[model samples]
Target: MAAENQHQVPPPPGLIASLAGLAKNCLHLLLSRLELAAIELTEVRDTLLQLSIVFAIAMLAAWFAIAFGTATLIYLCWEAMGWKILALLAGLFAVLAVALVLWGRSLVRQGKLGLSSTMAELKSDRDMLL
Candidate 1:
């Protein structure tokens, strides 16, 4: 029975066959990872597009609302404050602009948008493979 079993067993693959199988497996793995990345990229693109559209609409609405409100406020106080309200609003806008610029600069300096996660994954793969 043992002799019969031994005879029935398959032979080991040759070196070339082993290498070809490894290459085929590596190709499959690469293709799968690429597909996953493509899917994620598509999702991110869709979300970003929607967010941009909504933000633009909201910003437009807010701009008109603020403009009307400010105009009304100035009209109401026209006799009392004269041009002081306009000057005050201008100063407020200047301060807000400075604050926003500084905040944006800080975000850039922190490298928050830099592809940190992908870079880390690439580094780990490199370390593992090499």
Candidate 2:
């Protein structure tokens, strides 16, 4: 029995080594994917910041232009229409502003600003894992 046990080969050494190596590789892959996700999030944040700044500047400029244009129009018609043009212009602008506000609200309700690509990538990753 002792002779037979001695003659029997030990399990292959590569088995344990291969399992360790696979675990290490999986850890590395997970770290890489996390890094990629972080990078993408940073890019999205920077883009949003830039867009916010641009939109704020645009809104300011538009407000100034509208104010000046309305003033100019009122001045031009002041002599001909007396003070009545003021009321008409005010009412017209109010109606238009309300319409624009409603349109903007509708767009917001529709969630047009969702992170579509990021969500898609996450979904794909989930599918791959499953």
Candidate 3:
């Protein structure tokens, strides 16, 4: 009769304690998984940051190389070719510019230029604005 009464009563505190312990264990497992994920994410971010830094540095170095090469070429030409050659080159450049302008005018007369189409599109867009 006494054992039956005990069984009928609410289960002892031990079962409730065990349930709390199980909950804690589950929580700890979940937290550890989250920590692992965070660590991986941090590592990935660091790697990406490093790669971006390296790429920027490489671009900067390449730009420096290009600037140095252009300056060197100009210096060599000015020093070796003398001022007379430089003057002649400048005259040639002016002539080339004039020739290109005349050629462009001829092409416009032939209707080979796309500028009119572009200008029409621009005008249409401008009309829509008004």
Candidate 4:
């Protein structure tokens, strides 16, 4: 018991204090990154909502234009090319639609909708920690 009492000197203060400070700084960094992610999420939501509205409007206008233009073209080509014009135009529109769908899919696959800045910052933080 006396030997135990003699060995009761305190641990090094600097290491403990530094660990506490490091814990505090890590917590602060996590909180700031979370806040930034939240802000970016809100912005992304707003942007997606706006894009949905605009895409809806554009689709509506495009449908009307496609209908009128197709009818006019069919009328103009009916006398000369007859039914072949209709089949050709259909095939052409089908190819165009397929191309557009492929492009949109590629964009999706490329992660165009991801939170770039947040991901970059997280990667940098991870790199620094490692």
Candidate 5:
């Protein structure tokens, strides 16, 4: 039986071809996934850029408005309350700034800027590999 099996044939060629095909398929899959990730990253970057521009413009406008409004308010109240209202408004602005900073820091800590979907897919791939 052993001699007959040896004389029949070796399967290296077919086995190698199968392995090569599988490897090619895997490479194609990986490249496709990478392309998808690149597209997603580009979209995220574009959205962030657009939002940053809008936010910057809005912030500039708001700053000018706030400056003028505050000046008017202080001038109008100067004869009655003097600097007391100005000090109170300044303190209130400082507190608001502090709160905004803390909230932004917390969002960063929570990974709000991360590529979450890509990270999740990569993690799943890693788990499958392991």
Candidate 6:
């Protein structure tokens, strides 16, 4: 029975050719996946770099505008106007500060603004639930 079921083996060339084809196909699949991953990584890197650069430029512009405006205002106030205007400016600032404090308190009472204590209380509640 064993002798009757015995089959002839394929030629060496045929086996080698099949193995080479399989290897080539596997290498192609591996390279395609690697190429896709590389492209996705490059796109992510580029997007992050662009976002960081834009944020930095915006911060720099904000700082420049603040410094320039403050300097211009001080120069106009001290050099252009006399010392008498300084007293009036101080009084105006005091009044504005008082007004802002009152307004902020009113908003807090109305629940329109969250003060530091309120924020802490909300955070504690969220933590407890979580």
Indicate which candidate wins on lDDT. Answer: 4
> What TM-score does prediction 4 earn?
0.78
* Candidate 4 segments exceeding 4 Å error: 1-17, 109-111
| Global lDDT scores for all candidate models | 0.79, 0.83, 0.70, 0.93, 0.86, 0.69
- For candidate 2, the lDDT comes to 0.83
Report the C-alpha lDDT of model 3 over 17-117, residue by residue, as the tens digit.
Answer: 99999789768755765565566667667867997799799879986985687567567788677676557666866896799799868966885323444
Each prediction's number of clashing residue pairs: 0, 0, 0, 0, 0, 0
Per-residue accuracy of model 5 over 1-130 as CA lDDT, tens digit each: 8779878856556888999998998798689779878988898899889989998999999899889989999988999999898898899899989998999799779975677878788788778878
What tens-digit string does per-residue lDDT give for candidate 4 at 1-130?
A: 9999899998767988999999999999999999989998998899899999999999999999989999999999999999998999899999989999999899789976788889999999999999
Q: Arrange candidates, best lDDT first.
A: 4, 5, 2, 1, 3, 6
| Model 6 spans > 4 angstroms off | 1-13, 61-130
TM-score of each: 0.72, 0.58, 0.36, 0.78, 0.76, 0.36
lDDT of 1: 0.79
* C-alpha lDDT of candidate 4 relative to the true structure: 0.93
Name the better of 5 and 6 by TM-score.
Answer: 5
Worst 10-residue stretch by lDDT in candidate 2? 111-120
Q: Candidate 2 versus the native: TM-score?
A: 0.58
Question: Can you tell me which runs of candidate 5 are displaced by over 4 Å?
Answer: 1-15, 106-112
Better of 1 and 4 by TM-score: 4
Model 6 clash pairs? none
Go through the candidates in order and give the C-alpha RMSD of each one to the true structure.
Answer: 3.6, 5.9, 20.9, 6.5, 4.9, 16.7
Instruction: Supply the global lDDT for candidate 3.
Output: 0.70
